[model samples]
Target: MEWYLKVLKNYFGFSGRARRKEYWMFVLISTVISIVLSLVDLGIGTFDEETGSGLLSTIYGLAVLIPTIAVSFRRLHDTNHSAWWLLIVLIPFLGALFLLIVFCFDSKEDNQYGPNPKAIPDDNAEIEA
Candidate 1:
């Protein structure tokens, strides 16, 4: 939940590196929220069978669209890849597979993108005794 909130707080931030936990946590939580919204829309008859999305779900997707891209870009930066690498998603199955593999790669040492996210201390972390 902290990771998800951190990403949302960054909102349009795309210039820094994103740790894998940050990126994946946002994905996981957002996916769960979308599912819940879809169920709500279904119960309210707002879900459209044609597009397979509901009013709330659609709105939520649009709301997070930019943030999602921003996080992906930052994740790429963490892996030492340019944001342009995201274009590979247009290549069908292979592109997504390639990106999935890349996203799983360990974060590189401080690169042109910025310092390694893992090296930065979290402001919200509890102080050690």
Candidate 2:
């Protein structure tokens, strides 16, 4: 929850790196909330079968659309990639698969994008032989 809220607090932030945990946690929670709102809209008869979108769901999606994109951009930054790479999503099927792979890659420590969000303390003792 903290991770999700942190992302929301920086709702329009796209200049920093986001840890895998923060990105994934926000996605997980948002998905769960969407599902719940969909059910509510269905009960209220505000769901449209034609478009497969409910009033509540649509409203929620619109509200968070920018934040979602912002997080995705930050996630890409964490991998040391440029935000322009997001255009790959327009390439049809391969685009999403490629992005999935990219987002799953381990964060590159202190890259041009920014510092690694998963950085460990340098003060920790090393396992010297």
Candidate 3:
């Protein structure tokens, strides 16, 4: 939940590096919310079976579009890749698979993007003995 909120707080931040935890957690929470919203839309008769999507989810998707792109850009940057690499999704199945693999790659030591997020301690984290 913290990771999700962190990403949202940086909603338009497309220039920094996003650690794997930040990227994946945001994806996980967003997916769960979309599913719940879809179910709610179905119960309210706002779901369109033909299109296989619901009004609430559609609206939610639109609301997250920019943030999604921004995060993807940052994630790619984290891996030392240009944000333009995100366009690889347009190449069909292989492209998406490639992107997924790229996302999974461990963060490279301070590259063109910025310092490694993993090396930076969280500002709100508590110190331990």
Which residues of candidate 2, in runs, are more than 4 Å off?
A: 120-129
Q: Please, what's the RMSD in Å of model 2?
A: 5.0
- Model 2, range 1-129, lDDT digits (tens) per residue? 777788899989999888787788899999999999999999999999999999999999998899889999999999889998888999999999999888888875798876777675322125222
Return the TM-score for each candidate structure.
0.94, 0.89, 0.93
RMSD of each: 1.8, 5.0, 1.9
lDDT values, one for every candidate: 0.93, 0.87, 0.91
Which scores greater on lDDT, model 2 or model 3?
3
lDDT per residue as tens, model 3, 42-124: 99999999999999999999998888888899999999999999999999899999999999999859998899998998964
Error of 2 at 13 (Å): 0.3
**lDDT of predicted model 2:** 0.87
Tens digits of per-residue lDDT, candidate 1, 23-117, equal 89999999999999999999999999999999999999999999999999999999999999999999999999999998888875899999988
- Runs in model 3 lying further than 4 Å from the true structure: 127-129
Most lDDT-accurate candidate: 1
